[model samples]
Target: MKARIVAETLVKGITVNAIAARHGLRPTRISDWRRKAREGKLVLPADKNAVFAPVKLAVPAIAAPTPPVPVTTIDLLKGDVTIRLAGDTPAARIAEIVAAL
Candidate 1:
């Protein structure tokens, strides 16, 4: 292929005449390919020296969720007096406390 022949010329020790001789092609043909590449018409492969490896991504571990803590304080104020009780105290008990105050 023209691309392969052109790529050969790009190698450090390889020459257009040598590549043309090896492929039984005219050196002028390879020159034309190079010209086309310079003019943005032909595409060339990556350089042999430029190597790459595939990348792998790892999955992260998930942690167990913690339980929520319950908030447990209620306050009642009458004049200058303050009363504190558990948030779960019954409404009837609160009414009795309020009436006693």
Candidate 2:
């Protein structure tokens, strides 16, 4: 489909505006195709020699592993509690845990 070609071109680093100009398509339509590609809903054409060639789908990159989080240990009258918090940990949950203790 014409839309798929535009999307594949866009995924290959071609600008959406350029694809629109080259294919005589509207820029908005090209943007829609890019969105579909990002969502994995667009079907790209396969090469004859490389049937499973990876298409550069417009997806977000996976974040690298962060450093180990600091663990805070509190000694209570009843018992000692150890709390481990990571860089990605939510502040609200940490507050709740501390409150419960």
Candidate 2 lDDT by residue in tens digits, 1-101: 85466545645567777878888889898777767867778766655455565788788899999977665543323266566556455778767777887
Model number with the top TM-score: 1
In model 1, which runs have C-alpha deviations exceeding 4 angstroms? 51-101
lDDT of 1 at 5: 84
Please give the clash total of every predicted structure, in order.
Answer: 0, 0
Question: How big is the positional error of residue 40 in model 2, measured in Å on the Cα after superposition?
Answer: 1.7
Taking every candidate in turn, the Cα RMSD to the unseen true structure, in Å, is 16.4, 11.6
Looking at model 1, residue 30 earns an lDDT score of: 89
lDDT of 2: 0.67
Q: Which lDDT value does model 2 have at 48?
A: 43
